[model samples]
Target: MRTDSGLRLEADPRPPRALPPVPSAIQGDTPLSRPKKKKPRTKNTLGSASSEGLAQAPVHRPSEGSELPAKEPAEHPEEAPIQRRQRKTRLPLELETSFTQKKASNSSLLRNENGIHVEPPEEAVTQKPRRKTKKTQPAEIQYANELGVEDEDIITDEQSSPEQQSIFTAPTGISQPVGKVFVEKSRRFQAADRSELIKTTENAEVFVDVKLSWTTRDVALTVHRAFRMIGLFSHGFLAGCAVWNIVFIYVLAGDQLSNLSNLLQQYKTLAYPFQSLLYLLLALSTVSTFDRIDFAKTSVAIRNFLALDPTALASFLYFTALTLSLSQQMTSDRIHLYTPSSVNGSLWAAGVEEQVLQPWIVVNLVVALLVGLSWLFLSYWPGMDLSEELMFSSDVEEYPEKDKGLKASS
Candidate 1:
């Protein structure tokens, strides 16, 4: 381009210098270059000025990869006390950072007194072991032969061998029959001992069946004794009366005695048998009263005499005889008292007075008295001593002490 001075201002005509050749190593290593140096971190001073500044200033977040400086002690001694008071009053930046980190780390981050970093305590975790179970075996069929027979019978045909049979039959010491026999003998011995104990108890004298020992013989003997006493008294009296009657008849009318005798003879056929029976009964009663008769034999005699009551029979015969004699004396004109005077004759005819007692009447009165006495004795008569007769032994025990006392007394 031309200037006003008319000189040609030619552009520098030097060819663009050729650029130098780049090194390949430097181009290849460009991506692997070192990182840029970071600026030095600012430290948080724990002083009253910094604390006051931090309280007034808004909180600011640090960029990534930036480190906060450690806290430095106060420089001035006079400010140290005020710095500590401020530190106590206001929260520190490091403490706030640590708390934020703890929250972000889910409480895993911890801080110590000098703001040292700490890790959370480790927890032990246990895992349970799996259990193993054993498989169940199949059920077996039990047959009746398997229940009662030997083990040899339990095996299958394939297992039935001579060795198995020998193993089962080897024990010869245990004998079931011998053991059963011993048990049976033991039971029998125990039973015999028990029976002996029972027998001993039975043989011990106890007075239960006391009345069973009372035999009819004892009752018969007692009755016989009572009757014998009565008969002895009554017979002697009656015999005396009969003798007196015979004498009186002889004195009153000796000629009439034959008639009276004939009259007695007429009734003798009937009277003699009854009279003999009465005498035989009286004799038997007397014999029984005196003799020690066997009670067993007495029971047999009582059974035989069950058909007749001896006391009633004897009384009936005596009364009948008396009645016949009284009738004969009253009806017959032969048996009477003899009166020679007319007054006596009139007295006899009037039947108002009696000089002598009638023999028949005397006999009847004696018999009546005997019957009355016999009845009275029977009414008061004590029966058999059943307690004594039946008792096998006294209720009192025969102790050795009693016997010793008796011997000492003797």
Candidate 2:
């Protein structure tokens, strides 16, 4: 409408608009329909100022018939600190129904809050019973008749009386079964318990399978055979020495003491060969002992000797010969010496010293060198035999064997 003279003409007053109908489903309160609003942050100072303004500002409620707020709403700024919260739109029946169905679902839950459904455990399954054994009348009279027989006779004719009662049937408080009489006797013979006793099916026959089978004779035979191999080794050396020792002791000494003179008389026969043989046996035994030493007292030397080659046996023997030679020289030299010329022509005439001394020294020196060389060969490798040769050359000069017979009579 146009206004004249700067005065506007007012339009006629308009009737109030009718509100849209609220949905029936949206009418009820629901958790999903609750209001959702953005929180507005305000400075603490401005918030307090607003609060004071609110307290000072007048609040006017709407008239009784009015559907609007009781008081006129406060004017809000474009970006007001106080927010008017908008209520959430209520969901349709289909969405609410889906929600209700999800709540009722047990797929993602343990159970309903109200209760849980449970089925009773299945009853124990029944099984068919086994058939009962048939019962036969016991022959008590037959047992009584057998019991009447002497106890000793029962052993002789064990099965002759049939229908005998089981040992368990005896009324008295007997510890053993009555039927095991022969078994008990057998156990006594076996020197064992009842479990060890055996019974024969026929005629209560009993026999003892004694464990006393390992007799001394059998063990001795086994031991002898085992040691026989060791004996062979020892006996071989003995055989070789026997003749040598005997001849050196008897024939050689006999001839040497017969009579010879001068430097020749200084010589005597020596039993170095026999001494070597004895030492060899000792070495072999030591080797065997090394291998056979009981668990309690084994030594490293014994272990080494056992593993040593058989050829080493000869080396051991040779070393033994050298040791015996050295020992004999030391022992023989300790004996009191005599010059035959110092005695009467008759007493010195026998030429005992001339018969004995020089030859023995020569032989002993030779044996010692041989043994020492052998020991060196075994003890040190490469240039080992050279050491022995040098020693031999040096010691050999001590013996002068130009004479044949030179042993004094003992």
Model 1 TM-score is: 0.21
Q: What CA root-mean-square deviation does each model show from the true structure? A: 49.1, 40.9
> Which consecutive 10 residues in model 1 have the weakest lDDT in total?
125-134
- Against the true structure, candidate 1 has what lDDT? 0.31
- Each model's TM-score? 0.21, 0.20
Per-residue accuracy of model 2 over 208-295 as CA lDDT, tens digit each:
2232565655675466446635634553444345334444443443565453343223322223334545566645533432233221
List runs of model 1 lying over 4 Å from the truth: 1-262, 283-368, 382-410
Worst ten-residue run, lDDT, model 2? 125-134
The true-versus-predicted C-alpha distance at residue 235 of model 1, in Å, is 15
What clash count does candidate 1 reach?
1
Q: Candidate 1 lDDT, tens digit per residue, 222-292?
A: 67557656655654455454445445434543363434333332433433343344344434433322221
Cα deviation in Å at residue 82, candidate 2? Answer: 77
